[model samples]
Target: MSLTPLNNIGEFALLERLAKLINIYNKDKVIKGIGDDAAVIKPDIDLVQVVTTDMLVENIHFDLSWMPLKHLGYKSIVVNVSDVVAMNAIPAHVTVTLAISNRFTLEAIDELYEGIRLACENYKIDIIGGDMVSSNQGLIISITAMGYINKENLVYRNGAKPNDLICVTGDLGTAYAGLLILQREKKTFMANPYYQPDLQNYEYVIEKQIKPEPRIDIINKLRELNILPTAMIDISDGLSSELHHICRQSNTGCRIYEDHIPIDMMVSNIADEFYISPITMALHGGEDYELLFTIPLNQYDLIKNIDDISVIGHITDANEGMYLINNIGEAIELKAQGWDSFKKEE
Candidate 1:
């Protein structure tokens, strides 16, 4: 029997295959292509359009071994919304396409949509359209989100300026730690079938990993505060990686304070148990779904007084380079070591 193609290929390659299969909708109006977090479309109106797509493959982005289908569905939309938020745009709609193998039952699909429904309700977006296809492989979900913003309001990675204040919304590293807890529990269960997996104490972190809320409210809140980010990127990737994108594209440097990086108490306690630095995990660990941004110095007072947002550091001239300042007052060069989905080890 001839083997199936998607069975052997990985998630990214499969995404590449799918990307090639689709025809461009507005080839001429497309200001940006499909590579970044969202596609930039210059609609006839003054407002620019932003589009983003995400694909989740079993055993790659997620593991059916432990992840619930419902959480998976909810997470699918949130991830897409996070991308739109990164562009400083509001997520207005999403088209979810699901590919399911024979292994999943109709009831399971309903459970999955339950999460999808919940996300739509929370994000206040409509499920405009999508498709359902059969797969010989495991569960696969792809989400495409559409966002809108005024042309002048659109923010990309290439706008940070020297002396700009670096700020982030919500905390970091909790989702990454949540991933660790889930994987660790899976291992514990695999090692001994009787092991129930000690995850009760790690509830908060694990919940963060399973179902994350996109910072749509924060985006609106920033507008209410009359703050415009000089540059903005979501924390789907590590903080260091997103910061590097900001610094490199903006031709600026950032000095992130070690003590300023936010960490939930549960995340810190778990990091201590694992013999890891909470700050390190928050910086290098990926998928917090928070916003990393730089605002002009005049806006410093606006963010500094905000309880939910923190002014972690300041941007500098590109010649200075990106560095992290420890509590001891030493500056260390920051590295953007993002999680590699393809070369991931079990």
Candidate 2:
């Protein structure tokens, strides 16, 4: 085992050393590798290309304390894949760019890439090419994903119309509740050195926070049924935020039923322990990484039979605007007051 003088060697030197470690998935598609301003890849076939990127920063997006390097790498890919899934496309390739400070070592880098490489295998995506730079700040990982879709099958955020049904994939807010548990556990550890945090419980909630998968299967099923979302966006923001985006983009209004929002049983129990309503967690709590979109009213029965797809609401006339129809029938405005790490005061 050996330690790298990663700091003293400087950023460019580290990049030079790391150059040996990476290669394009297809040697032929790589017009240029690590040295240039960017790496270019030839488009596959006459297929339409979709591109998306995600950035993860230390402490803000991840904590090294409990997060395994493998899960972190897997998460980076999932976030990018979610963007492709939002577009109703199957993600086919990804390029990972990493920035490191003096804190990490060669062994640590291997663990991180080990996770990244495993995600490539699971998602059936190719690792094209990427840049490794040394930074003065803590670790940062930025991933760019590429996906392919038929021109006719493409889904975007700007297609909703009146009477379209609002649909979402899987459960929501489990990830958000899971995050609360993780942060609380992390705090407990920092407060008492002798106290071992009791994490005997909350495994399911924790798993959602740590390793989320993009809903590509649902996208495929929808396509198989000859259905296309009137409008679509991944649920990275809270449900309230996403619905608002669909409404604004498509020049439509929406109404969601409070009871229809999907929430997992484990998340519900944990939320009760924390004195939080699972519904509130799903509504305003972000990071579910699910898909939220609208479909035509006639397509409702076609989509409902599919497992995990929930018809939470529907698009309405422009005058109605976007709001949630509570169980008691009271209407409330939808607002997106989600996590804003960039705005936090140091």
Per-residue error for 189 in candidate 1, Å, reads 1.2
Model 1, which residues run further than 4 Å from truth?
1-44, 343-346
Clashes of each: 0, 0
lDDT of 2 by residue, 193-227 (tens): 78787767878778888888888888888888989
lDDT of 1: 0.81
- The TM-score that candidate 2 achieves is 0.90
**Poorest lDDT segment (10 consecutive residues) of candidate 2:** 337-346
Which candidate has the top score in TM-score?
Answer: 2
TM-score for each of the candidates:
0.86, 0.90
